[model samples]
Target: MAKTFASQGDLAEKHTSFTEVGDGVYAFTAEGDPNSGVIIGDESVMVIEAQATPRLARKVIDCVRSVTDKPISHLVLTHYHAVRVLGASAYGAPQVIMSDAARAMVVERGQEDWDSEFGRFPRLFQGHEEIPGLTWPTTTFSDSMTVYLGKRRVDIMQLGRAHTAGDAVVWLPDAEVMFTGDIVEYHSACYCGDGHFADWAGTLANIAGFEPVAIAPGRGDALLGRARVAEAIANTADFVESTYRPVAKVAARGGSLKEAWDSARAVCDPKFGAYAIYEHCLPFNIARAYDEARGIDTPRIWTAERDREMWAALQG
Candidate 1:
């Protein structure tokens, strides 16, 4: 029989744990899956990154229920990815926040992304019927916005584009913890399907200024201490560097995207072999890296049809 996905036979569903990173800061992680961060303020709460579906998002709510009774007022999307934003309706956080660029991306390519991603990873969206529609952010900012969770300060800064053109980080200066959305994937592979390589590196440097002692990355274990935090950033940077350099080098030499893919595969296939979705991501990674190397700052929309065409053109 073919292997199954999403449903982990190891652990029954509805097992969400709220891990306290600091006094009021918590991370809601499901059995080794994508993580969501919660910041409890003087009154209300702020949630970062909605899961795949409303039903899946409720799992985070169940985790939050274990901690406190504060009502969640804001839902912040780190980027415009379908897996991260589709579950917004579950929270009903009043204000769904994202970068202006992210909102624009949703307008431009969200439907295509929905189809493409749902096709790519069926397990993530286990309860697909629960998804009402494409998630839209009612409140958006071009660069930054500071939300007062009663009295606590949460700074939303869009330093530079990395994972996506509108990628942003949730930073708590006093606590010195930042929720880097897919910017620092620990165990999972960085999905460079719509990434900007050079800008991503610059974004990493920009994040360094805050010097977050604890970081809740888009995936993997939340870093509870400083050293592990730095390790996460360094590891992310190394992966980004390794993936892009070969692609750029090949593209600069007038080689085709196919050649770039092969060269990048030679380097990444062995090193990043263990990371989840490494194979599924390589073709898109090579495509984006090649485009950036050729001076394309903004990545093009990735429709489901375009997905297969690109895959076949580059690898098939």
Candidate 2:
């Protein structure tokens, strides 16, 4: 999983893939890097998350163009991660939307996240020079909002905080499908540096509340059928819980961060080793989980320097 990171000077250059999860929805993934979801409505289109740059985002747009010519009217940021929202300009949508809390995250740490993620995973940002700037949401809401593309109804709701403080999901009630960004990753190492473990588990239950026929998780292959979807949710929950619980116990016992990291590695790596980015993400996930379990409520800002320090200590 060393492939997931690079220094600030490095940049991402990887192949991409697009798969259809439903009749009108698509998931764009790159070697288990961050994933992007697209939903085509009756007369327009909605993009769930933007790539790290406009140039990279256009690849997904180009693929969609091969199937339909509907104008992309909305770009919905599932959260404020730079890899997910910085590509908004490429969509050229009339409105860029996200949860109100998501917008706040952008204001609070969008710039720092940009630097933090660029340093952590340069392979995910293929065309960094094309980035316009930190992405800002043009529209936002508190709990839930419904958007109509002609007669098609798409429900966007902030189910609860999981991956981030402002995590949200896009649901197609009629289609019985949902786009759960990072809430349910299938066979992928989840990035939990800024996540809330307890809240995240509860949010997964909220997503299960929809009983979606299929779910496009933030990473890995899209899950189809009720059983597969449930597996996705449960698998991700297990990853998150296993990443936190034992490490938290170690920390609570006054174990050093390195000791906590080692314990998590011994436990989680065996269980999730084959999963994508398991090694690259484990250090950060363990560190943050340890901190959160010790009552650090808000996630600390991750600067480039901090990223290297943490990596050298835990993974180098």
RMSD of each: 3.1, 2.1
**Which digits, one per residue and each the tens of the lDDT, describe model 1 over residues 92-164?**
7468899999999999999989988876667677889989899999899989999998778999989898899
lDDT of 1 at 235: 82
Clashing pairs in 2: none
Off by over 4 Å in 2: 1-15
Q: Tell me the tens digit of each residue's lDDT in model 2 across 1-316.
A: 3543433333445567787878888878776767888888888888888878897788878987977898989888899999888888888755898899998888888899998887766666768888889898888999999999878899999888888989889998777889998878999889899999889889999999889998888988878899999998999999999999889989899998989988887788789988877766788898899899899989887887888888877755
Best by lDDT: 2
Cα TM-score per model? 0.92, 0.94
For candidate 1, the TM-score is 0.92
Query: What shift in Å separates residue 94 of candidate 2 from its native position after superposition?
Result: 2.9
Tell me the whole-model lDDT of each prediction, alpha carbons only.
0.83, 0.84
At residue 111, candidate 1 shows an lDDT of 91
